[model samples]
Target chain A: MMAEQISIFIENKEGRLAEVTAILRDAQVNIRALSLADTTDFGVLRLIVNDNDKATAALKKEGFTVGKTQVLAVEVTDEPGGLNKVLDPLCEQDVNVEYMYAFANPQCKNAIMIFRFDDIDKAKEILAQKDIKVIDGKELSGL
Target chain B: MPIFDIDFETMPREGLEAIQLRRLQTTLERIYATVPFYKETYDKAGIKPTDIKSLDDLRRLPFTTKQDLRDNYPYAMFAVPMEQIVRIHASSGTTGKPTVVGYTKRDIATWAELMARSMSAAGATNGDIIHNAWGYGLFTGGLGAHYGAERLGASVIPVSGGNTKRQITIMQDFKPTILCGTPSYILHLAEVADEMGVDFKDLYFKSGIFGAEPWTEEMRQELEAKCNLKAVDIYGLSEVIGPGVSIECVEEQKGLHVFEDHFIVEVVDPDTLEPLPYGEPGELVFTSITKEAFPVIRYRTKDITSLNPTPCTCGRTHVRMNKPTGRTDDMLIIRGVNVFPSQIESVLMETREVAPHYQLEVDRIDNLDTLTVKVEIDETSFSDDIKGLQAMEAKLSHDIKEHLGVSARVALVEPKTIERSQGKAVRVIDNRKL
Candidate 1:
C-alpha cells in the first residue's frame, strides 16, 4: 500500500531543527522514518508521521515551506542481506529507487523499510509479484 | 499600413544627410547663442557654429559628459529662458548630484512625435490598446511613452508601475494589445501572472516594447517564450528625450533604429575619443540636433554598442545599433577580466532551476578579487536531492567561468529571498574597495 512523507524546506542555520521539533512536539505528532537531504545553503527534512495533516499544518503555520511526497512501506528481513531483498527484483525489473529509509515497530517482527521509486506503481507490482508484504498507510501509522 | 513618417524614414541617404546638416547647424547656432556652457566650450575650442559646414564637421565639437550636466545642476544647461521651458526632469542622482534636463512646449510636441514614431515602429497602432506600465512623472519612461501612445492615436492605459495584481486583472479585462515597460518588470509581471493562475497567453498581448536597461538576446527569447509576444527593444534616456530616442521595428527585431532626424549618433573609442567605423563596438555618443530647450553637443552616453549602417528588413534607411552589452558604470573588473551583469543574466536565463532575479557581489577575499552570484531558486525547481542541488550550483559556476572566463561562486537561496525593486533592480554590490 502507498504511504506519504512530508518534506520541509529549512534554511541552513542554528536551532531550525529544534524549532521544527518543538512545533511537532506542541502539536503531539510522532515522526516515524525521517531522512534529511542537505546542501550548503538549504536542506529538505523528510518525515513519515502518525498524523500527517496535523504535522503539516503545524510546520506550515510557523512559515516553513513544506511539500508532500508519496513513499512505499515494505517488510525487510532483520538479518544479513536484509536490504538487498528489496533492491534485487526492483533492479532486475529496471524500477528506479529514488530514495529509501527504514523504521522499526514493536508489534512487527521485521523492520518496515520506506521506498521512494521513480515509478511507484511499477515498483508496487514488482514487489507484489514477488509476494513481498507492503503495509498500508493507515496500518503503518497506527503501528 | 505605411511606416511612420514614410518620407523621412525611407528618405534616400543623400537627402537624409542634407537635412541632418541643416538641423545640426541650426542647433549648434542656437546653443552657441543662448547657452553659456556651449558658447564657452566652443569658443575655447576656436570653432564657431558656422565652421560646421558638413556633417563630418560635427567631429570637431567637444564631448559633453554626464559630469558636465551634473556640474551645471538645475537650470544652467537650459538653452531657452524659464518662460519658454514648460517641463523639467532629473536623474535619480544615486551617485551624487542629479543631472537635470528641460523641455519647452514645442520641444514636448516634438518629443511626442519622435516617441510616436518609435512606438509605431515597435508595432503599436491607432487601433491597438496600449498598456503603458512605465513609471510616470519625474521618470521619463512613463510620460515619454504615454505621450507617444497618445500621439500614435492608440487607446492608452496609464497604469504606471506597481499594483501588479490589479494590473494583471486590468490586462484581462481591458485586453491591451501592446505592453510598454522595462524588461525586468515585464518578466516579473509574467511570474506574478503564473502565481495568480492567469496565463500570460490568455492576456492576448501581441507585442511588448521593453527598454531603459540592457538585456541580452537570451533574455529576449525567454521573455518572448514566457510572455507569448514579440519583445521589441526601445532605447532612450532622460537626458536625450526619454523613451522615444530610438526603437527596434517589430518586423526586424535585430537592431534598434535611431531617429536620425532629431539626433545624431556616433560610436567612439571611449579611451581615445576617436569615432569608430560602423560595426566596431564602442561607447555611444549622441548629439541632439533638434532639441530646443536642452541641446546636447556630442553627449557621451557611456553605453557600449556597435552601429550597423546596412539596410534593415523593414526598409528604413536610418542606421541601426546593436543591443548595448552594458553601461561602463555597470561593468565589474574581476581579476582583470571585464564581466557585465547582463552576461551573468544571460547565464541565469539559460537554466530553468534558477529564477531571473539575481544579484552579483564582488569582493576581495585573501587579497584576490572574487565574484559571487546570489540567485533565487525557483519554487518549482526545489527537490529533495541534495547532490542534485550542489550539482546545479557547480554547473552555474562552471558556466560563469566558461562564458566570462572568470571564476565565481553560485549561491542558490530560497524563492523570494532577493528583494524586488519597484524601479530598476540594483543588481551589483561591490564590496572590495568600500
Candidate 2:
C-alpha cells in the first residue's frame, strides 16, 4: 500500500532541475511521476521513481540533499471525475493529502496517482473500504 | 588647521611619561583606597601603590578582564562616591550581564576634551556641523561623539542612527561637514544616498570619524571612495572611555594616536600575557590613569593590535596603535552588534529538533555585515515536507533574533553536514576581514 518516493533538495538556480534529472537518467532510474515545490531560495524535487534506493543513492552521491518519503500509488478510473471520486472518500474520513501527482498508465484504461498523506496507513484503510485499487510499489514501478 | 590642545597634543616624550606616571600613581592610590575589587586584586599580587616607582613597574598589577567587570556587576568598581558619579554607559553583554562604567563630572569633561582632540585631528573645526549617527542611551558611541563635537564648539545634529533616508535628508539640509558613526553605517548611508539620486560627494560631509567596531583598511578605502570624505578610524571601548580613546590623524592614516595623558596603552601577547615589543601585533590592554569614577587598571581589551612608538608625521608624540586585526575572544561583531557563538548555541539547544552541530558565518554584503547561522537538523525531526522545514528555519531564526537582538538567516542543513572537530569545533567563519 505504501510507495517509496525520492525527494531531492535543490537550490533555486538555473539548471538544478535538469541536473537532478540527468543524474537519474545516468543512474538508469525511471521517474514515473514528478512534482516540484519551490520557494524564493530553494526547491524540493519530488519524484515517484522506478528505483527509489538507486535514485536516492545516485542523487546523494552527486551532493544533493535527498530523502526517502512513503507515499501511496492508487489506480483510479480514467474519467473526468476520477480524482474527485478518490479524494471525496478520503476527505470524509479526515485523511489529509499532503500532495499528489498523476501519470497515465498505457496498458490499462486507468491513471496512476502518487499521493503523500499525513497518515499513509489510515489512507490505505479508507481506500480499501471504498474499494479503490491501491497499487503496490512493484506493480506501480512496473507500470 | 588649529590643533585642539597645543600643550598636550605636541607634548615631548619625557613630559608625556611624567604626566602618565603622576596620573598612574594617583589612580592606583585612589583605586586601592576606594574599590575593594582592585584592592583585593592588587593585594593578592603583593603590590601596593607605593611599589609603583616607575611606569615600567606598573606591570606588577593583576590584569582585569571582562569577567571581572561582570563579577562587579553595576557599581562595585566605582572609585568615587555615587554623588560624584555623573553618568553611566554599558556594553551590550550578549552572553551575560552588561559591563557598566560610571563617569565623574571631571571624567566626562576629560572624555569631551579627548573627543574634541579627535575631531580636530580629523580636520573638523568649530564652524563644522557634525551629524552623529552612533546610537545614544546607555551605549557610549552616540553621546560620546555628540558631547565631543559640542566641546569642539561644532554644531551637532543628534540624529542617533537608523532612518537611513531621513539621515540623508538631514545631511542635505544641515550640510554637516563631519559625520560620526560606525564605518559600515556610513557606507550604508552612502548607498542609500546614491539610490535617492543624491551624490555623497556633493554633500557637505568633509570628514568621517567612524568607530564602535573593528573594520578593515579595505572597508576604509571603500568608505572614502563612496562617501567622498576622509574616513578616519576611531577606536574605543566602554570599559575605557568610549570612542575617543584613540583617533587617526587626517595627516597620516597609519595608526590612531592614543591620548597618553589620560590612558596608558600596552600590547601584550594574548597567550602568555607577556608584554609584546612595539610594532608586533598582540592584545591591547588599557589602564585608565585619570578616570575618577570607574578607573580600570591594566584592563584586558582583547583587541589584537600593536603600537607604533615612533612619532607621527602629524607631530603627535603620543604612541599610535595600528588598526585592530582581530579579537582574542570568540565574540563576533555583526553590523555593530555583538554576537557570541555560545548565545547562538544556547538558543539552538532550546529547540529539540536541531542538533548541537552549528556554524556561524559572518559576511559583508553591500557594506553591511550579514550573519548566517547554519545548523544541522536532527535525524528524528527530518522531514521531506518543504513547508515544515521552512517553518522550522523561520522559527529558529526568530528565536535567535529574539534572544540575541541581531537578525540572522538560519539554514537547515542535513545532519552530519557540518564538519565535526576532534577537539573544539570551528564554530565561526567570519569572512569580514578586520
Per-residue lDDT of candidate 1, residues A1-143 (tens digit): 89888887777878888888899999999988788877777888899999999998997777665678888999998889978888999999899988888888668578988888999999999999988889989987898
lDDT tens digits, residue span A17-86, model 2: 9989999999999888899987776667789888888997897787666778888989989879989889
Best by lDDT: 2
Question: What is the Cα-based lDDT of residue A2 in candidate 2?
Answer: 78
The clash count of every prediction, one per candidate, is 0, 0
Residue A58, candidate 1: how far off, in angstroms? 45
Error of 2 at B414 (Å): 2.4
Instruction: Write candidate 1's Cα lDDT for B112-190 as tens digits.
Output: 9988888889888899999998877677888988888898899999999878899999999999999988776687788
- Per-model TM-score, in order, reads 0.60, 0.85
After the best TM-score superposition of candidate 2, give how far the Cα of residue B202 lies from its true spot, in angstroms. 2.0
Model 1 residue runs over 4 Å out of place are: A1-143, B331-434
Candidate 2 Cα misplacement greater than 4 A, ranges: A1-72, A89-96, A103-107, A117-130, A135-143, B74-76, B80-88, B92-97, B420-424
Best by TM-score: 2
